[model samples]
Target: MLQAKVAVVTGAGSGIGAAIARLFAVEGAKVVLGDLAEGGAAFAAELADDGFEVMFQRVDVTDEADVAALMQATVARFGRIDILVANAGIPERKSPIHQLDLDDWRRVIDVDLTGVALCNKFAVGAMLATGGGAIVNMASILAHVGQENSNAYSAAKAGVVNLTRSVALTYARQGVRANCVSPGYVDTPLLAQLPAAVRQAMLLRQPIGRLARPDEIAQVVAFLASERASIITGACINADGGYTAI
Candidate 1:
């Protein structure tokens, strides 16, 4: 489905990012996986063992230099970039407004919001070189709703939504398509860390009565990154299992 594409996925060491990287490789795209974790290289090796076009890079998305290096390494290895998934992010600690640490708030903003901006800036230049590309950003269902003591995370994701729109408009005529995917609670390691009560509450909130699988979210991302979604740009797809339908 994505044959001939050269793709970059951040936070690809695990979870949703890892799933997207593996899926894209299966569809014939040469993929570059970037992560801050040590396991990224191991995952890349595993993918390559399966005869897939893939590689790994250590990247700090919040750093302009690291993000630039990721894109440069991708182009050097695959010729040009055709798809970018700005999926690297961290969740803020749950805390009341008055109890929130300033450092924590700033850190989340930098990683979740500024990091995406850096990825888009560098990716845009590379995509422009090859005519155009697709960019799928990871937002959250929390972007549309509010939860007590989770203001930082919600705000950062909300920023991503608007940032995606701005990117799409700036490059709409230049062949860049940017969009956001807002997912509800997903069955990821992060979710596992939540207490049983919290986890069950999240599950009950989903109309489907279950959390989303990482691969399910990956499939939606894959579709957005393909020509099959040619006319789609600046739109946010709610992959929330009808949670926002109400």
Candidate 2:
């Protein structure tokens, strides 16, 4: 799998990012975990105690200096970076487009869209210098379909999807591969924070009658990051449990 690789996963404190980091570690990558939450450090410590090569760094992805330092720290510790999972993002509460607060809209866009840009800026430069690497940006089902009252999230994710393609095309010849994963209704801690009714409604909308598990998304990411997907780049793989099929 990822043996000998140095991998960076944003938002690795929990949810899909944490799952990806754990999977990469199990597959033999030295994992560098970053997130704004303190839990990210604890997660890294726990994994390191279990004998995994893991490091934690506090980062607000939206901040330029923080993201640059995150990449530099990983390189300093691991020597070279082989993979990047741009999975840090935030979702806004539901609000009609007309009623959506300007601040909330900017918040989502900053974290979801601009954050990925900053990560890629540093990650790609490192990858190019190291000869080549792989990237998996976490998008969402909203990237393709409409999600009422989630304009900012949807728009940001859509931007991620396109940004992935652009990166893939621009750097594939240079040995850098970029792809995206669009997940639907994953039962992460973030979902637990939603209102009971909102959660239920999401569950009901899933054709499988249950939310996607974080590991499921991680499996897809692992595949995209592996040599098995060597010919795959600029692709968007959907893990929506048929949510967009209808």
Candidate 3:
């Protein structure tokens, strides 16, 4: 669906971001994988080996300069950025609001919320210059429903949802569309870190009775970034497996 398009995926080192990068490449996009982890380079190389057009750039999403550089480098490499998946974020350190450290909250807010803002800011500028493009921001089910001890993460994700809407509204006539993909608990490295009991609890909470796969979420993102979703903007599509229904 993304044939010949130039796409940039942040946090492409592993997990959902990696999956998005790979899928975009397979769909014929010139993929630029950006992450703070140097490992993203190797992942890009792996994709290139499969004869996909891909590149990697180390990017600290929370840094405005770094994010600007990412968009610039992508334009330099692929000519123009047709799609941007702002997927770079850090897992929150769970703690009750009363007991949460200031640093923990700030860190999560900075990366999860501010990083997305930075990406959108620069990507939108680039897209405007080229007439138009699409943006898919990675949010979570937490954005729709709150969880105990996850104040920072939930707040940040909720912020992302609104941020996407604002961008969509602001650029609706400019040909740039912005949307959010809110996923449920996914079977990624992040989920693997939880205890068995915690994992089971999440499964029980989800109506699907199984965690989502990274590729499944990637499919959602790819669709949002493609012309298939041309009329979609300012919408937060839930891929939560009915987690919020109950």
Candidate 4:
């Protein structure tokens, strides 16, 4: 559905971000994979080997200049950006609000919330110059339901939801569409670090009887980034396997 479009996906080194990059490329987008991890270059090369148009660029989403350079480089390579997936983020440092280290909170907020803002800031600028485009910010189920000891992540994701709405409203008439996807427990590398029992507990909590696959969430993102969702803006689509339903 994204044939010939230019798309940029942050955090595209692995997990859901990587999945989105792969899918977008397969769907015919000239994809730019931006990540701090070296894996992004290898992954982009892998996609290129498969005959998809792809490129990799290292980015520190928390650094405005780095992010701006990423967007600028994308336009320099692909001419214009048609879609952006703001998916770069760090996991929360588990701690109660009262005991949460201020630095830890800032770290999560910087990468999760502020990173999305930076990506949006430059992506919107690039889109506006090209007559508009679509954006899909990555959020999480924690944005809607509380998670123990994950206060900062929830807050950041919640900020993303509203940030998406704000951008959508502010740029609707300008032709830019913004939306987000909130995913539940997914079988990504991030989840592999948890204890087995914890993983099982999370799996059991999913009404779908299993954790979602990263590609499943990527599918939702891809849909939102395409004209298939042309009328969807400022919306948060849940790909949570009913985690928030109960």
| Number of the top-ranking candidate, with TM-score as the measure | 2
Per-prediction TM-score, please?
A: 0.98, 0.99, 0.98, 0.98
Q: After TM-score superposition, what is the CA distance of residue 111 in candidate 4 from its true location, in Å?
A: 0.2
Which segments of candidate 2 are over 4 A away from where they belong?
none
Give the C-alpha miss distance for residue 60 in model 1, angstroms.
Answer: 0.7
User: In lDDT terms, how accurate is model 3?
Assistant: 0.94
Per-residue lDDT over 1-246 for candidate 3, one digit per residue giving the tens place of the 0 to 100 score: 999999999999989999999999989999999999998999999999999999999999999999999999999987898999999878877777889889989999999999999999999999999999999999999999889889889999999999999999999999999999999999998788888988899988989999999999999999999999999999999998889888
Q: Which scores higher on lDDT, 1 or 4?
A: 4
TM-score computed on alpha carbons, candidate 3:
0.98
Model 3 weakest 10-residue run by lDDT: 88-97
lDDT score of residue 123 within candidate 1: 96
All models: lDDT?
0.93, 0.95, 0.94, 0.94
How much does each candidate deviate from the true structure in C-alpha RMSD?
A: 0.8, 0.7, 0.8, 0.8
Position 224, candidate 2: lDDT: 97
Q: Candidate 1: give the clashing pairs.
A: none
After superposition, which runs of candidate 4 have C-alpha atoms over 4 Å from their true positions? none
lDDT tens per residue, model 2, 1-246 = 999899999999999999999999999999999999999999999999999999999999999999999999999999988999999999887888889899998999999999999999999999999999999999999999997778899999999999999999999789999999999999899889899999999988999889999999999999999989999999999998999998
Candidate 3 stretches with Cα past 4 Å from truth are none
Worst 10-residue lDDT window for candidate 1 reads 186-195
Residue-by-residue lDDT tens digits, candidate 4, 1-246: 999999999999999999999999889899999999999999999999998989999999999999999999999998999999999988876777889899989999999999999999999999999999999999999999987878889999999999999999999999999999999998888888777988898988999999899999999999999999999999999999998999
| Model 2 TM | 0.99
